[model samples]
Target: ALLGQQETNLSDGSQQRVTQLLKTAEPGGLYGAAGDLSDALPYRDRPGGLRAIAQVHDRYILAEQPDGLCLIEQHIAHERVLYERLNDRWQLVPLTTPVVLEGLNEKQLEQFERLGLAPEEFGPNRWAIRQAPEPLRDRDDLPDALLELSLGGNLDTAQVAIACRTAIRNGTPLDLATLQTLLDDWQRTRNPRTCPHGRPICLTLSESSLARFFRRSWVVGKSHGI
Candidate 1:
Protein backbone atom coordinates (compact mmCIF):
# COMPACT_ATOMS: atom_id res chain seq x y z
CA ALA A 1 0.00 0.00 0.00
CA LEU A 2 1.31 3.46 -0.84
CA LEU A 3 -0.35 4.95 2.21
CA GLY A 4 -0.89 3.30 5.56
CA GLN A 5 -4.13 4.64 7.01
CA GLN A 6 -3.41 3.47 10.55
CA GLU A 7 0.00 5.08 11.01
CA THR A 8 0.09 7.29 7.93
CA ASN A 9 2.99 5.14 6.84
CA LEU A 10 3.60 3.58 3.43
CA SER A 11 4.20 -0.12 2.78
CA ASP A 12 4.85 -1.99 -0.42
CA GLY A 13 5.63 -5.65 -1.22
CA SER A 14 4.11 -7.82 1.46
CA GLN A 15 6.99 -10.26 1.10
CA GLN A 16 9.96 -9.22 3.22
CA ARG A 17 13.40 -10.16 1.87
CA VAL A 18 15.32 -12.63 3.93
CA THR A 19 18.69 -11.20 3.02
CA GLN A 20 19.86 -8.19 5.05
CA LEU A 21 22.84 -6.03 4.07
CA LEU A 22 23.66 -3.99 7.14
CA LYS A 23 26.73 -1.85 7.47
CA THR A 24 29.92 -3.56 8.64
CA ALA A 25 30.31 -0.89 11.31
CA GLU A 26 29.30 -1.64 14.88
CA PRO A 27 26.12 -0.45 16.49
CA GLY A 28 25.99 3.37 16.62
CA GLY A 29 28.45 3.38 13.74
CA LEU A 30 28.63 6.15 11.12
CA TYR A 31 28.83 4.91 7.55
CA GLY A 32 31.04 6.29 4.80
CA ALA A 33 30.34 6.23 1.13
CA ALA A 34 30.13 2.77 -0.48
CA GLY A 35 32.04 4.15 -3.49
CA ASP A 36 30.91 4.15 -7.11
CA LEU A 37 28.70 1.32 -8.21
CA SER A 38 30.04 -1.21 -10.69
CA ASP A 39 27.29 -0.28 -13.15
CA ALA A 40 29.00 3.13 -13.64
CA LEU A 41 26.40 4.92 -11.60
CA PRO A 42 27.92 7.66 -9.49
CA TYR A 43 24.96 7.84 -7.14
CA ARG A 44 27.30 7.52 -4.19
CA ASP A 45 29.84 10.10 -5.20
CA ARG A 46 29.87 13.37 -3.23
CA PRO A 47 31.84 15.96 -5.18
CA GLY A 48 30.46 14.95 -8.54
CA GLY A 49 28.13 12.11 -9.45
CA LEU A 50 24.41 11.70 -9.47
CA ARG A 51 22.67 15.07 -9.26
CA ALA A 52 19.22 15.90 -7.95
CA ILE A 53 17.13 17.22 -10.83
CA ALA A 54 13.46 16.85 -9.91
CA GLN A 55 10.88 15.10 -7.78
CA VAL A 56 8.27 12.71 -9.15
CA HIS A 57 4.80 12.21 -7.67
CA ASP A 58 6.04 14.49 -4.87
CA ARG A 59 7.28 11.35 -3.16
CA TYR A 60 10.31 10.18 -5.13
CA ILE A 61 13.49 12.20 -5.50
CA LEU A 62 14.53 12.36 -9.13
CA ALA A 63 18.25 12.48 -9.70
CA GLU A 64 20.26 12.52 -12.90
CA GLN A 65 22.74 9.64 -13.30
CA PRO A 66 25.05 8.93 -16.18
CA ASP A 67 23.02 5.92 -17.28
CA GLY A 68 19.60 7.55 -16.96
CA LEU A 69 17.53 8.61 -13.96
CA CYS A 70 17.10 7.39 -10.40
CA LEU A 71 13.92 7.54 -8.40
CA ILE A 72 14.50 7.44 -4.64
CA GLU A 73 11.56 6.91 -2.35
CA GLN A 74 11.90 9.83 0.08
CA HIS A 75 10.17 8.21 3.00
CA ILE A 76 12.03 4.90 2.84
CA ALA A 77 15.29 6.63 2.05
CA HIS A 78 14.96 8.77 5.16
CA GLU A 79 13.67 5.76 7.07
CA ARG A 80 16.76 3.77 6.21
CA VAL A 81 18.97 6.71 7.08
CA LEU A 82 17.28 7.18 10.44
CA TYR A 83 17.25 3.43 11.11
CA GLU A 84 20.98 3.07 10.53
CA ARG A 85 21.68 6.28 12.42
CA LEU A 86 19.67 5.07 15.40
CA ASN A 87 21.54 1.74 15.22
CA ASP A 88 24.56 3.45 16.76
CA ARG A 89 25.02 3.38 20.51
CA TRP A 90 22.77 6.09 21.88
CA GLN A 91 24.02 9.14 23.70
CA LEU A 92 21.50 10.30 26.27
CA VAL A 93 20.36 13.91 26.20
CA PRO A 94 18.23 15.31 28.97
CA LEU A 95 15.27 17.39 27.93
CA THR A 96 14.97 20.99 29.06
CA THR A 97 11.38 20.45 30.09
CA PRO A 98 10.72 16.79 30.79
CA VAL A 99 8.10 15.32 28.46
CA VAL A 100 5.15 13.19 29.53
CA LEU A 101 3.88 10.20 27.58
CA GLU A 102 0.58 8.39 27.92
CA GLY A 103 -1.10 5.21 26.61
CA LEU A 104 1.61 2.86 27.78
CA ASN A 105 0.94 -0.26 29.79
CA GLU A 106 3.28 -1.58 32.49
CA LYS A 107 4.98 -3.96 30.08
CA GLN A 108 5.35 -1.26 27.47
CA LEU A 109 6.75 1.06 30.10
CA GLU A 110 9.36 -1.50 31.04
CA GLN A 111 10.30 -2.00 27.39
CA PHE A 112 10.38 1.75 26.81
CA GLU A 113 12.62 2.22 29.78
CA ARG A 114 14.72 -0.73 28.63
CA LEU A 115 15.45 1.27 25.50
CA GLY A 116 16.90 3.86 27.95
CA LEU A 117 14.16 6.44 27.61
CA ALA A 118 14.37 7.33 31.32
CA PRO A 119 10.74 6.62 31.83
CA GLU A 120 9.02 7.50 35.08
CA GLU A 121 5.50 6.80 36.17
CA PHE A 122 3.66 10.14 36.04
CA GLY A 123 0.21 8.76 36.80
CA PRO A 124 -2.12 6.00 35.80
CA ASN A 125 -0.66 4.76 32.47
CA ARG A 126 1.42 7.90 32.05
CA TRP A 127 5.20 8.03 31.77
CA ALA A 128 7.55 11.00 31.93
CA ILE A 129 10.75 11.29 30.00
CA ARG A 130 13.72 12.52 32.02
CA GLN A 131 16.26 11.89 29.29
CA ALA A 132 16.23 10.70 25.68
CA PRO A 133 18.68 9.29 23.21
CA GLU A 134 20.69 12.01 21.47
CA PRO A 135 19.28 11.34 18.03
CA LEU A 136 15.68 11.39 19.32
CA ARG A 137 16.15 14.50 21.43
CA ASP A 138 16.97 16.66 18.42
CA ARG A 139 13.64 15.83 16.87
CA ASP A 140 10.64 18.06 17.45
CA ASP A 141 8.46 14.95 17.55
CA LEU A 142 9.83 13.08 20.54
CA PRO A 143 6.25 12.28 21.51
CA ASP A 144 5.77 10.59 18.15
CA ALA A 145 8.77 8.36 18.73
CA LEU A 146 7.56 7.54 22.23
CA LEU A 147 4.14 6.68 20.92
CA GLU A 148 5.65 4.39 18.32
CA LEU A 149 8.03 2.92 20.89
CA SER A 150 5.08 1.86 23.00
CA LEU A 151 4.28 -0.71 20.31
CA GLY A 152 7.73 -2.28 20.34
CA GLY A 153 8.28 -5.74 21.86
CA ASN A 154 12.06 -5.37 21.94
CA LEU A 155 14.82 -2.79 21.59
CA ASP A 156 15.66 -3.41 17.94
CA THR A 157 12.08 -3.48 16.75
CA ALA A 158 11.29 -0.36 18.74
CA GLN A 159 14.23 1.52 17.25
CA VAL A 160 13.22 0.62 13.72
CA ALA A 161 9.63 1.67 14.38
CA ILE A 162 10.75 4.93 15.93
CA ALA A 163 12.85 5.67 12.87
CA CYS A 164 9.87 5.11 10.62
CA ARG A 165 7.80 7.51 12.65
CA THR A 166 10.52 10.13 12.78
CA ALA A 167 11.55 10.00 9.14
CA ILE A 168 10.12 12.42 6.55
CA ARG A 169 6.78 11.08 5.36
CA ASN A 170 6.02 10.17 1.72
CA GLY A 171 3.80 13.16 0.99
CA THR A 172 6.38 15.68 2.10
CA PRO A 173 7.84 17.76 -0.72
CA LEU A 174 11.42 18.84 -0.04
CA ASP A 175 13.33 21.74 -1.52
CA LEU A 176 16.30 21.07 -3.78
CA ALA A 177 18.74 21.80 -0.98
CA THR A 178 16.91 19.43 1.33
CA LEU A 179 16.71 16.78 -1.36
CA GLN A 180 20.40 17.08 -2.10
CA THR A 181 21.26 16.81 1.56
CA LEU A 182 18.94 13.85 1.96
CA LEU A 183 20.48 12.16 -1.06
CA ASP A 184 23.95 12.75 0.35
CA ASP A 185 22.97 11.14 3.61
CA TRP A 186 21.12 8.35 1.82
CA GLN A 187 24.19 7.62 -0.28
CA ARG A 188 26.32 7.41 2.83
CA THR A 189 24.11 4.73 4.35
CA ARG A 190 25.52 1.20 3.94
CA ASN A 191 22.20 -0.32 2.92
CA PRO A 192 20.60 2.17 0.55
CA ARG A 193 18.75 -0.44 -1.48
CA THR A 194 16.27 -1.48 1.20
CA CYS A 195 15.22 -0.08 4.54
CA PRO A 196 15.53 -2.26 7.63
CA HIS A 197 11.83 -3.09 7.34
CA GLY A 198 12.41 -4.33 3.74
CA ARG A 199 11.11 -1.41 1.67
CA PRO A 200 13.03 -0.25 -1.38
CA ILE A 201 14.88 3.06 -0.95
CA CYS A 202 16.21 3.81 -4.43
CA LEU A 203 15.07 2.66 -7.88
CA THR A 204 17.07 3.23 -11.03
CA LEU A 205 15.37 3.37 -14.43
CA SER A 206 18.45 3.17 -16.55
CA GLU A 207 18.56 4.29 -20.17
CA SER A 208 18.62 0.68 -21.30
CA SER A 209 15.35 0.03 -19.47
CA LEU A 210 13.49 3.10 -20.73
CA ALA A 211 12.00 3.40 -24.22
CA ARG A 212 11.34 7.09 -23.58
CA PHE A 213 11.96 9.37 -20.63
CA PHE A 214 11.18 12.95 -19.70
CA ARG A 215 12.20 14.91 -16.61
CA ARG A 216 9.65 17.26 -15.08
CA SER A 217 10.41 19.44 -12.05
CA TRP A 218 7.60 20.91 -10.07
CA VAL A 219 7.60 24.09 -7.99
CA VAL A 220 9.50 23.79 -4.69
CA GLY A 221 7.61 25.42 -1.83
CA LYS A 222 5.37 24.93 1.21
CA SER A 223 1.96 25.21 -0.56
CA HIS A 224 2.83 22.09 -2.52
CA GLY A 225 5.22 20.64 0.11
CA ILE A 226 7.69 20.04 -2.78
Candidate 2:
Protein backbone atom coordinates (compact mmCIF):
# COMPACT_ATOMS: atom_id res chain seq x y z
CA ALA A 1 0.00 0.00 0.00
CA LEU A 2 1.05 3.62 -0.48
CA LEU A 3 2.60 4.64 2.83
CA GLY A 4 1.94 8.39 3.00
CA GLN A 5 -0.30 11.19 1.74
CA GLN A 6 -0.77 11.93 -1.95
CA GLU A 7 0.57 14.98 -3.75
CA THR A 8 -1.95 17.10 -5.63
CA ASN A 9 0.07 18.37 -8.59
CA LEU A 10 1.21 14.96 -9.87
CA SER A 11 -0.83 13.42 -12.69
CA ASP A 12 -2.35 9.96 -12.29
CA GLY A 13 0.27 8.39 -14.52
CA SER A 14 3.13 9.81 -12.44
CA GLN A 15 1.60 8.54 -9.25
CA GLN A 16 1.03 5.05 -10.64
CA ARG A 17 4.58 4.85 -11.88
CA VAL A 18 5.89 5.94 -8.48
CA THR A 19 3.83 3.24 -6.75
CA GLN A 20 5.10 0.52 -9.05
CA LEU A 21 8.72 1.53 -8.59
CA LEU A 22 8.44 1.58 -4.82
CA LYS A 23 6.85 -1.86 -4.91
CA THR A 24 9.71 -3.30 -6.97
CA ALA A 25 12.86 -1.51 -5.77
CA GLU A 26 15.27 -3.48 -3.62
CA PRO A 27 14.98 -2.87 0.09
CA GLY A 28 17.79 -0.89 1.86
CA GLY A 29 19.29 0.29 -1.41
CA LEU A 30 18.87 3.49 -3.46
CA TYR A 31 18.05 3.49 -7.16
CA GLY A 32 18.25 6.33 -9.67
CA ALA A 33 18.14 7.30 -13.34
CA ALA A 34 19.12 10.52 -15.15
CA GLY A 35 16.21 12.66 -16.30
CA ASP A 36 16.06 13.63 -19.97
CA LEU A 37 15.28 17.31 -19.33
CA SER A 38 18.50 18.08 -17.49
CA ASP A 39 18.61 21.57 -19.04
CA ALA A 40 15.17 22.65 -17.87
CA LEU A 41 14.97 21.28 -14.32
CA PRO A 42 16.63 23.35 -11.61
CA TYR A 43 18.22 20.27 -10.09
CA ARG A 44 19.45 19.10 -13.46
CA ASP A 45 22.62 17.55 -12.08
CA ARG A 46 20.60 15.25 -9.83
CA PRO A 47 20.05 11.68 -10.98
CA GLY A 48 16.47 10.59 -11.71
CA GLY A 49 14.42 7.53 -10.71
CA LEU A 50 13.88 6.25 -7.16
CA ARG A 51 16.59 7.62 -4.88
CA ALA A 52 16.65 8.00 -1.12
CA ILE A 53 18.13 11.18 0.33
CA ALA A 54 19.51 11.89 3.78
CA GLN A 55 17.22 12.56 6.71
CA VAL A 56 15.95 16.12 6.32
CA HIS A 57 13.96 18.29 8.79
CA ASP A 58 13.99 15.32 11.19
CA ARG A 59 10.59 14.48 9.71
CA TYR A 60 10.59 13.45 6.07
CA ILE A 61 12.70 11.17 3.87
CA LEU A 62 13.38 13.21 0.73
CA ALA A 63 13.73 11.09 -2.37
CA GLU A 64 14.26 11.98 -6.03
CA GLN A 65 11.86 10.49 -8.56
CA PRO A 66 11.65 10.49 -12.34
CA ASP A 67 8.95 13.14 -12.21
CA GLY A 68 9.83 15.03 -9.05
CA LEU A 69 10.57 13.66 -5.58
CA CYS A 70 8.86 12.88 -2.26
CA LEU A 71 9.34 13.38 1.46
CA ILE A 72 8.73 10.58 3.99
CA GLU A 73 8.66 11.63 7.60
CA GLN A 74 11.55 10.08 9.51
CA HIS A 75 10.09 9.87 12.99
CA ILE A 76 7.45 7.35 11.93
CA ALA A 77 10.06 4.91 10.71
CA HIS A 78 12.51 5.61 13.54
CA GLU A 79 10.06 4.82 16.33
CA ARG A 80 8.92 1.52 14.88
CA VAL A 81 12.43 0.15 14.38
CA LEU A 82 13.80 1.41 17.70
CA TYR A 83 10.92 -0.01 19.74
CA GLU A 84 11.25 -3.43 18.17
CA ARG A 85 15.01 -3.54 18.52
CA LEU A 86 14.95 -2.42 22.14
CA ASN A 87 12.38 -5.06 22.98
CA ASP A 88 14.21 -7.84 21.14
CA ARG A 89 17.63 -6.97 22.53
CA TRP A 90 16.38 -6.42 26.04
CA GLN A 91 14.61 -9.74 26.00
CA LEU A 92 17.83 -11.46 25.01
CA VAL A 93 20.05 -9.40 27.34
CA PRO A 94 18.79 -6.68 29.62
CA LEU A 95 20.52 -3.29 29.91
CA THR A 96 23.72 -4.03 31.74
CA THR A 97 24.47 -0.63 33.25
CA PRO A 98 21.35 -0.28 35.39
CA VAL A 99 22.02 3.43 34.99
CA VAL A 100 21.87 5.35 38.25
CA LEU A 101 20.53 8.86 37.86
CA GLU A 102 21.13 11.31 40.67
CA GLY A 103 19.38 14.44 41.96
CA LEU A 104 15.99 13.38 40.78
CA ASN A 105 13.02 15.32 42.07
CA GLU A 106 9.94 13.59 43.46
CA LYS A 107 8.40 13.52 39.99
CA GLN A 108 11.46 11.94 38.39
CA LEU A 109 11.66 9.37 41.17
CA GLU A 110 8.06 8.51 40.66
CA GLN A 111 8.58 8.22 36.93
CA PHE A 112 11.41 5.73 37.30
CA GLU A 113 9.44 3.84 39.87
CA ARG A 114 6.58 3.56 37.43
CA LEU A 115 9.04 2.22 34.90
CA GLY A 116 9.90 -0.48 37.47
CA LEU A 117 13.46 0.75 37.80
CA ALA A 118 14.85 -0.11 41.19
CA PRO A 119 16.40 3.14 42.37
CA GLU A 120 17.38 1.85 45.79
CA GLU A 121 19.56 -0.85 44.30
CA PHE A 122 21.30 1.61 41.98
CA GLY A 123 23.12 3.25 44.95
CA PRO A 124 23.36 7.04 44.59
CA ASN A 125 24.57 8.06 41.15
CA ARG A 126 26.35 4.78 40.82
CA TRP A 127 24.25 2.34 38.88
CA ALA A 128 26.00 -1.00 38.46
CA ILE A 129 27.14 -2.00 35.02
CA ARG A 130 26.02 -5.44 34.06
CA GLN A 131 24.59 -6.71 30.74
CA ALA A 132 24.10 -4.19 27.96
CA PRO A 133 21.46 -4.74 25.33
CA GLU A 134 22.54 -5.66 21.79
CA PRO A 135 24.50 -2.95 19.95
CA LEU A 136 25.39 -1.43 23.33
CA ARG A 137 28.21 -2.09 25.72
CA ASP A 138 29.31 -1.06 29.17
CA ARG A 139 30.91 2.26 28.35
CA ASP A 140 32.77 4.50 30.79
CA ASP A 141 30.39 7.41 30.29
CA LEU A 142 27.53 5.65 32.02
CA PRO A 143 27.04 8.53 34.43
CA ASP A 144 26.67 11.14 31.69
CA ALA A 145 24.46 8.74 29.79
CA LEU A 146 22.17 8.22 32.74
CA LEU A 147 22.12 11.96 33.34
CA GLU A 148 20.88 12.48 29.82
CA LEU A 149 18.27 9.75 30.22
CA SER A 150 16.86 11.41 33.32
CA LEU A 151 15.94 14.56 31.41
CA GLY A 152 12.76 13.25 29.83
CA GLY A 153 9.49 13.20 31.79
CA ASN A 154 8.39 9.65 31.08
CA LEU A 155 10.44 6.49 31.39
CA ASP A 156 9.38 5.08 28.04
CA THR A 157 10.24 8.20 26.08
CA ALA A 158 13.45 8.78 27.98
CA GLN A 159 14.61 5.22 27.59
CA VAL A 160 13.76 5.07 23.92
CA ALA A 161 15.64 8.29 23.14
CA ILE A 162 18.59 7.24 25.24
CA ALA A 163 18.75 3.88 23.58
CA CYS A 164 18.57 5.40 20.12
CA ARG A 165 21.24 7.99 20.85
CA THR A 166 23.43 5.38 22.48
CA ALA A 167 23.09 3.04 19.56
CA ILE A 168 23.89 5.77 17.09
CA ARG A 169 26.66 7.54 18.98
CA ASN A 170 28.81 4.80 20.55
CA GLY A 171 32.43 5.34 19.53
CA THR A 172 33.04 1.97 17.98
CA PRO A 173 32.61 2.12 14.24
CA LEU A 174 30.46 -0.74 13.03
CA ASP A 175 32.40 -3.19 10.94
CA LEU A 176 30.86 -4.86 7.94
CA ALA A 177 29.94 -7.83 10.06
CA THR A 178 28.38 -5.59 12.68
CA LEU A 179 26.57 -3.54 10.07
CA GLN A 180 25.12 -6.71 8.54
CA THR A 181 24.19 -7.95 11.99
CA LEU A 182 22.49 -4.65 12.76
CA LEU A 183 20.61 -4.77 9.51
CA ASP A 184 19.59 -8.36 10.19
CA ASP A 185 18.45 -7.51 13.69
CA TRP A 186 16.58 -4.50 12.36
CA GLN A 187 14.79 -6.60 9.76
CA ARG A 188 13.67 -9.08 12.38
CA THR A 189 12.05 -6.19 14.25
CA ARG A 190 8.22 -6.02 14.13
CA ASN A 191 8.31 -2.51 12.71
CA PRO A 192 11.48 -2.17 10.69
CA ARG A 193 10.06 0.89 8.98
CA THR A 194 10.37 3.30 11.95
CA CYS A 195 12.52 4.10 14.97
CA PRO A 196 11.39 4.53 18.57
CA HIS A 197 10.47 8.17 17.94
CA GLY A 198 8.33 7.18 14.92
CA ARG A 199 10.51 8.10 11.95
CA PRO A 200 10.55 6.48 8.51
CA ILE A 201 13.89 4.88 7.68
CA CYS A 202 13.72 5.64 3.98
CA LEU A 203 11.60 6.80 1.04
CA THR A 204 11.44 6.03 -2.71
CA LEU A 205 10.41 7.28 -6.17
CA SER A 206 10.49 6.07 -9.80
CA GLU A 207 11.95 6.92 -13.25
CA SER A 208 8.69 7.32 -15.17
CA SER A 209 7.31 9.75 -12.62
CA LEU A 210 10.39 11.95 -13.06
CA ALA A 211 10.10 11.96 -16.84
CA ARG A 212 6.55 13.25 -16.67
CA PHE A 213 7.52 16.00 -14.23
CA PHE A 214 9.80 17.66 -16.75
CA ARG A 215 7.37 17.24 -19.64
CA ARG A 216 9.93 15.09 -21.46
CA SER A 217 7.24 13.38 -23.51
CA TRP A 218 6.10 16.74 -24.85
CA VAL A 219 9.64 17.69 -25.74
CA VAL A 220 10.27 14.40 -27.54
CA GLY A 221 6.91 14.56 -29.32
CA LYS A 222 7.55 18.10 -30.53
CA SER A 223 10.97 17.16 -31.86
CA HIS A 224 9.99 13.84 -33.48
CA GLY A 225 6.38 14.64 -34.45
CA ILE A 226 4.53 12.13 -32.25
The candidate maximizing TM-score is: 1
Q: State the displacement of the C-alpha of residue 123, model 2, in Å, after optimal TM-score superposition.
A: 8.0
Q: Give lDDT tens digits, candidate 2, residues 1-226.
A: 1223333446788787986654444332222343122222312333223345443543344555555555444344444556655655453245643654556666655654554544554666444434333433456765565455445566457558656665543233434444334433444556554466543454434346567767788797687755
Worst lDDT run of 10 residues, candidate 1, spans: 18-27
Counting clashing residue pairs in each candidate, in order, gives 4, 34
List ranges where model 2 is wrong by over 4 Å: 1-80, 88-101, 121-137, 152-155, 169-189, 192-194
- The TM-score that candidate 2 achieves is 0.46
**How far does residue 170 in candidate 2 sit from its true spot (Å)?**
12
- For model 1, the stretches where C-alpha displacement exceeds 4 angstroms are 1-48, 123-125, 138-141, 211-226
Local distance difference test values of all predictions, in order: 0.69, 0.48
Give the clashing residue pairs of candidate 1, or none. 28-87, 28-88, 28-89, 173-225
- On lDDT, the candidate that comes out on top is 1
TM-score of each: 0.66, 0.46
In terms of lDDT, model 2 sits at 0.48
